[model samples]
Target: MATDRLGLYVHIPYCVRKCNYCDFCSLPNGGAQVPEAYVDRIIDEILSYSGRVSTPVDTVYFGGGTPSLLSSTQMARIVYTIRKSLNISPHSEWTLEVNPGTLTKEKVDAFFNLGFNRVSLGLQSIHENEMKTLGRIHTFDEFISSYNMLRDAGFGNISVDLMYGIPHQTLASFKKTLDTVISLSPEHISVYGLIVEEGTPFYQWRESLPLPTLDEECDMYELAGRQLAVAGYEHYEISNYARDSYRSRHNSLYWRFGEYIGVGAAAHSFFAGQRYFNTDNVDDYIASSGISVTQTPESECDLEYEYAMLGLRLKEGISLSDYESLFGHSFIDGKEQIISRLEEAGLLTLDGDRLALTEHGFYLSNSILVEIL
Candidate 1:
């Protein structure tokens, strides 16, 4: 019998150059070539999970610093190892996160042949000044070149990554970026408002930065939804929009509270009522016999809270039956008063067994979820 479906997240924590706003587990190329043993080590890690993990793979996401740093032969070897060692479903959706100036026709063709059906390109903005302020390595011209090459390489499913609220960004610039992306008609679009976190250059200079005013930021975000909807894209998730069935299956698994296996540095996984993440130290992960993993304790309340928080991210919201089945209790019974209040305030909607936020509630989701969940 076939095993249950599982999502697999593979982390490639290497970037040609780290962006100013980035805090992901990755580092600059540092003028050194990629480690020769990188392929073997990752393959070894994959094989180590063989008998330990019982589920078959439904979706595989190669997220990064920049997975495009891997050469075609290296990617092929790693992919081949995954197929050889795991029970990958025939209908699996494999996605690779790439950046501009790092991909070419041959590299993407290799990925296409290896069964990678989706590509999420990092295109933060189309304006040159914004790109420079964000410390991105490539220009809009470079993104165009990379994008065209991927299309030529027969990639039908592509997701563009965009950002707003960058220093000196304006609503007009955001529109140009949005309109340009819409013109390309990619399968998906992910737009995030910039957040300056600690330990980053942006954080240090945040006070003096000419970042968007709170009101302007809100307008930019609101405008994103309106423009994207006009372009025939479904605002499926808070930060994501898709056309037809091109929604990201791997990401959907997370929002649904489904199980997944994460391999590589700083990769987090939740499966079988437990949560864990591998060490963030790349050198340590490479040299150790066994990776140091941290198991986070999740109490019953924590799980329920997490479910509600994550489910609220989707436009479809949470299903009553599904919630009850997972937690063995009625979600409505637990939060009827709060639901009634939110509904009265026009921030929430109840469609039979489903509970989701309204279009207005989308921008206020963080506050609403904090209150309800």
Candidate 2:
């Protein structure tokens, strides 16, 4: 939980099939690639950090198109490399993002043996029609099977991801999805609003798709917060909810502006007051050993803006004292009128030194942030 510690993010940019709405840097038909070569490249990238990054890594997150697609042996290779090359803490929270139908009992056991204590399952919906419309390869039954496999293997920390505002998705269907997932009682739940990114199939078909209107999406978001709270899950972030002590530690680092190092194709890093990212082209990453292309340094003013912006995503919001100490100026210096107006509208809460969004504010966080920042 300490901000001084580092987090490692390993990106696996391959998937069985690209979802219609996905625009992330990933290659479909990943099974056709030589797994061993990609795994070796990732290991090499990890070793490249040896002796350079000395901060103890307390969290490791395997995120991607589908990290569970890798063979257990392949995953083990990367895990071992990280342990050997980095100051990896023994109690680190290692999480793997898995898709249903890509896991088995043996694989689950292997992941546990490799020191993974958390598993994030991607289950967008429970309805057959919705899953089909989303281009998800797994059935609701497959997700249940995968969840059970993790539980049976003694993995207590599990997070299930759900989405609202999908094509042809309705409030009733989303509520059913929430009910079914809550019944499972996973340690954490993430409800995301769908974004139709440019260049994605959804963008091309935007007019024809039966996507939820802005009002409908807002309704679904409210429904999630209400139901998840009743189910004993804390809405810790804008989209993330968790039971006691189950908030995602790895992701928390990001919101807190803590330093982290990312490895693999299209991965990003925020460390030593600089932000940089690797090339999105997987083939180029393999050839270049996942070299990072650093960007221009952000101005001190830029840093201050970012720190407050990212911190406000948390329910805890920003500590005014800390912000002033870090930037040597009051966060409210120029934004008093804006903050006062937001508070009067019940969109923001200013409790002494802490400033955070109200539930309503979180729903319109983008516009609110634009005004404040």
Backbone clash numbers for all candidates listed? 0, 0
Worst 10 residues of 2 by lDDT: 29-38
> How do the residues 9-32 of candidate 1 rate in per-residue lDDT, one tens digit apiece?
999888888788999999798424
Q: After TM-score superposition, what is the CA distance of residue 369 in candidate 2 from its true location, in Å?
A: 0.2
lDDT of each: 0.87, 0.90
The collision pairs in model 1 are none
Deviation of model 2 at 288, angstroms = 0.3
By summed lDDT, the worst window of 10 consecutive residues in model 1 runs over 30-39
> How well does candidate 2 score on lDDT at residue 81?
94
The C-alpha RMSD in Å for every predicted model, in order, reads 1.9, 1.6
* Top candidate when judged by lDDT against the true structure: 2
